[model samples]
Target: MSTNFTYFADMSRKGIFSGHIQAMVYDRSKPFNSLPLLPPTGIEEDVDILKKLVSSSRALASVDGKVQRLPNPSMLVNTISLQEAKASSEIENIFTTEDELYKAVSDTIQEGQASPSTKEVLRYRESLWEGYRRIQEKGTIDLDGIVAIFSKIKNTSGGIRPPHSLTVIRRGQSEFRAGEIIYTPPRGPGIVEHLMANLLDYLSDKVDPNTDPLLKMCISHYQFEAIHPFPDGNGRSGRILNLLYLVNKGLLNHPILYLSKYIIVHKDDYYHHLAGVTQAGKWKPWILYILDAVEQTAKLTNQLITNILEQMESTLEHGRETIKWYTKEINELLFSQPYLKPKLVGDRLKIASRTTLNKYFSELQAAGMLAQIKDGREVFYINRDLVKILEG
Candidate 1:
């Protein structure tokens, strides 16, 4: 909590906290116009943290830009996207086993045909790719793009929450009596749209030249989450926006450096830092937390990329040494889909028949390069080492 950084509390209601809405009900009118804080001052620690964030951002950008040079970079994109999907969805308590997720990925065109958990994870990946495509096409971010991201995550016709929607942040496993409200976001016929408009400006070149783009991104994330624009999918959407904003600003060439797994591991601090800003005007801690997440997740991702490359090399070597024949194309296919199918493998290697591809899978499995797992009656062969690396 910073005594110097000043923040005004929106004269919002606290009934969401205690679940008592009689005389204690807050009118819920917290105006947030803190977007263009020129200095964003009050925290003496921000200078150092900002420097660190700049360096860390560059370090991440280095590998992200170089990873594209790899032979099969989409492997990282798809694998990282799915890992991020799983972690981000896990934050919402949507759980799926590793086997279930990999098998779901092996399925070609897995939109509606999956268990609820697996389907939801796949939607996150789909929406992320969609968001990436939109940003690439338009070279800008918009509310509709975000709506598209969330709609896929929830698999619905999604958009901003309507003013009449009684969407309050709460946590529980039951009905109205399940849990007390943690926060009540602004409610109005146009509050969400209005806030989002201001957010769009900050994300672009029109505002706050003094604040670094990365700093602006941290502020943007907090603002988006605080706005709670949608009735559902806000968390996943906000996270997707984080990466889009980075790519939009050219901080990352790809979305491989997502912070979901890191945030999931430090979820307590993630929420606490956000709450610290709202409760006591503590901006430095929140800024530092996000910067730290960027730094740490970048390191992990760089290492993951390194491990992936090394494993690819080792797999090639092992195949050539132990088997009578070898093809880098075949191994690339296996890496492309961690859970490999004979049809997918055949398509990649120009083999037409499943009967013939089965021989290849058997050879790979026999050489200790692939492991077979049966989802039901259908068996799926996977690169055991690669899957383990991805599951990390």
Candidate 2:
């Protein structure tokens, strides 16, 4: 459906625009003190948004349902959350390899030995889990919860940016207009808080109760990025907030949707749509892009989960048929993560006898279920199939 320019016209009357309504102009170099508030009218009635919303909601619900059926949902949570953390960080140009991430998670290397980028990525995962727990306990998302997320992500005790901080979103060094200001967030005393309070109210349905939760997510995401409350890590924090918002609205049981992968794939379009909202008040393209991200990521995640489950079943069948020491407990432990250490396996399985533990590993390796890797004195088994699915 098509929405007239009334929303922008109303916003202009409210002082959101710096020039005539026809031009819809605003200065990008200055703090955007007049940024419009949340719950833009007419979004719920847009035909294109509603059409995409149906498929997006269905796809998201499918993921939630499949995760609930797993014997150990936390296993999938741990794996998928890390993947999300990695991709989200990469969006900000913080890169880390899968090997480093899995190895750090498995404790095969010392914490201090992990690269700075890997540590930051781990912190992002920690922030995600912490936010999940807080939402579960509080039954609502609040300013304190958001601050906690940003703090954990950057490993700082700092809260929102003070009025003095001059923050501006800029282009990357590789871009043609590198270092040029893209958009400056709303600033000045009480301005950020005012916008954020409206955002929180919108999330709680205090602004508009009729809007669908999925649609609210799309709108709130844009508002959060536009607000840009924090000095750094706003991108990562906003991404985490997307998942938590889904869980808070009951559309997701756990944050296992893998949404960032789609964003990474369409990185340029992602930024363009975000800018469209701020510059020209183009909500349809932005909302449609987010809806498509949810739908595509949910489908990809379902397939990935299916592949992992199938691999687990195949591994169990192979072990039961070929290895004499196979057990359901061992199989589950092996699939808990892509990388497994001998000590970790022995400890979890209560196999105190080194000989017996070694035999189990030897048989699994001999059965082609696991590949042995030796790093100096450290030895670990790699679930090749599971890693491939996750990496894919």
Candidate 3:
């Protein structure tokens, strides 16, 4: 294969070295160009619309430092729209429910539960939920809390966090090398200094304290990823930075922006826009994409929350009629923990025997609020209506 090389000044007059890579200066005035930068195609354009809606949905979900409640209706609609696109997409191994994705992201951040394999997804959900809660209470974002999210998503496949090295592979090659480095950044010296300093400046200057915090977050995300300074963890760190930036701007009481869901769904486009900006200095397309994502995500999220409420209300009405004794208790239990085990019901309601808990759950199932997923020793109950509400 043909090789492409870049060289820097030698180590005598003024030079530095770190890692196994070497660098050199290139003519800055030369026209730097890459492959043809094209706008989204027809199918991609359609998907892009959904991506925008989901992005908006996520922004609206922010707690805004405990000053705002749940996202407004527009936000819910966008969230649901994005979810629909995700479910309809032909991508393999994609999560079908908003709950599954949200739970995965939230749990990871809040509990610090590391996935030995992709376990971080569960914690992702937990952490995200708590992030929203924090917004409600504190009315600010939390950077450190957001950064702890990646430990949970099990690195199953598809390179969750690729090392900061130029990747090279022909059409059919399976293996690759890491140390074939090039493209030295404009920093005088030190990697973290160049990236971190700019980030801190943007956070202080460009970010408007009052204008929609989520919008500011999208800007911060673009700036961080463009720098791509870290040798590793840049992707994950950039993402985490989104949540923290929101917190810093006081747009959310909790750092619960559902960005990854949209990004993961539109993974190809996300990369495409980022590359377009770096290669061609094209910012409009990326900015539009980010704005669109925030708008839609927020709308869809709000709708899901509404759907959940409706489902809960319907279940409560049924419980009042059939399961009279523990109707309120069971309803509260479902609201608190949508994923319920028989033992959990028994424990929460103070029921003595497994038999009684089973009876209560059976009553809920009969009333059409809950459904059972059973296979040998593992028996789980889902609020089917609630699931339906969220996906819708």
Using TM-score as the measure, which candidate wins? 2
Stretches > 4 Å off in candidate 3: 1-118, 126-147, 150-189, 204-212, 229-237, 336-338, 350-352
Q: Can you rank all candidates by lDDT, best first?
A: 2, 1, 3
1-392 per-residue lDDT for model 2 (tens digits): 02324644555587663322122477899887777766676677788889999999999999999999888999878988989999999999999998878877877454467899999999999999999999999999999999999999999999999988999988889999899998999887666877888899999998887789999999899999999999999999999999999999999999888999999999999999988888877888999999999999999999988998888888889889997778888888888888888888888878799998888888888989889887677677898988989987
Score every model by TM-score.
Answer: 0.86, 0.93, 0.60
Looking at model 1, which ten-residue stretch has the lowest summed lDDT? 14-23
Better of 2 and 3 by lDDT: 2
Off by over 4 Å in 2: 1-23
371: Cα error in model 1, Å: 1.4
In angstroms, how far off is 131's CA in candidate 3? 6.9
Clashing pairs in 1: 13-26
Instruction: Give RMSD (Å) of candidate 3 vs. truth.
Output: 10.2
